[model samples]
Target: MNGVIVGVRKDSQTYVNMKRKACAEVGIMSFDVDLPEDVPEADLITKVYQLNSDPDVHSILVQLPLPKHINEENALGAISIDKDVDGFHPLNIGKLAMKGREPLFLPCTPKKWHKDKGAKSSCSRSVRRSNIVGLPVSLLLLKADATVTTVHCHTKNPEAIIKEADIIIAAAGQACMIKGDWIKPGAAVIDERSQRPEQEIRIPIEASKVAGFITPVPDGVGPMIVAMLLRNTLDGAKWVIGQ
Candidate 1:
């Protein structure tokens, strides 16, 4: 199996390295394309097109948080849905949202949480409107028969909405934003923030006392995301080979 990873920023490079390492361990040939932060959007799309046509490249992943100038939607849309290992392609997400239509691959972080069928019994998504995490996750929850309420930055009385959820997915990227009092007692909290010293704790310590289950920022969703990425790559390769 073969996969191509394209990344620009320093932090994205770190994630790329982790994926490359995982690919190696799984015996998948991985290729890297490191562009400057200021690389032109057209050039990036051109590269994606090149990979889309490469028979050997079964999966293509564009590391996210592209430079402010680059259009994230355009970049993600350029990827062939068949080769979109990150599952960020609009078509894939569209299929994921519709009933009886399965996406080729689900967004990895949400897919990880989706594995827990129990969590899907009832869920709430705390996220900004984005392709990466919030919307896709809410769709998945809806499919699983969970009533999902998406609480974003602009949502009024976000805490009151959050406190009613049985499961809370914290993907808002704000540190300590989901306070202990915001959680419903015994609610499952999945924190999807990237780990940083200042933001080591995504959900505050007091949250753990009230939350029945809470995932740690550093050790929780990050590793699962990489694993899901690899799984998606393998699945993409299998589909190509008629497996």
Candidate 2:
């Protein structure tokens, strides 16, 4: 598998490192295109187009939280949908929302929540509304006939909402914001928020004793993200060779 990553933030360096480690472990060839924070949107789009045309590149990932000057939609649009390993392309998400139409790939993080982990019921709560994770997971749960409640900044009594969910997905990016008491006993929990090491350890350690299953910050959905990227790259490579 071969892929290219475009990023701007110093924090994004960690993602690059993570991806590299994952690629190395799986024997996937990787390439990176790190741009300055001040890079023009057009230049970023151009870079994506160039990688899109490269025969050796099976997947293209443009890291999120791009500089203000760069329009994320334009940058992501420049990538070939077939090579959208991150699965953030509009078409991929659109297909995910439509019944009976399979997306080329599911967004890595959200896709992991499809299975209910020994929860007492299929009632689920999503703490975000982004196209990437929250909405997709909610839609997938709806498709699976699970009762889904989506919480956002405007939601009243978010804790009470959480208490009703048999499956809880915290992707709001607030580190350790969700507590053990917020979780129903025996509930399945997926926390995708990352905080500092000390703070990150708190949620899992606390929630594990309450929730039926808790995904630790590092070993949980994090590794699955890299695995999914490789999987999508392999799928893109297969499509390229008409296999």
Q: Which model scores highest in lDDT?
A: 1
Residue range 60-154, candidate 2, lDDT tens digits: 88888787777778888788998998888889888888889888877877765554343234899988888778888887777777788999878
lDDT of each: 0.85, 0.78
Q: What is the TM-score of each candidate against the true structure?
A: 0.93, 0.89
Off by over 4 Å in 1: 119-123, 194-200
CA lDDT for candidate 2? 0.78
Worst window of 10 by summed lDDT in candidate 1 = 193-202
CA error at residue 66 for candidate 1, angstroms: 1.0
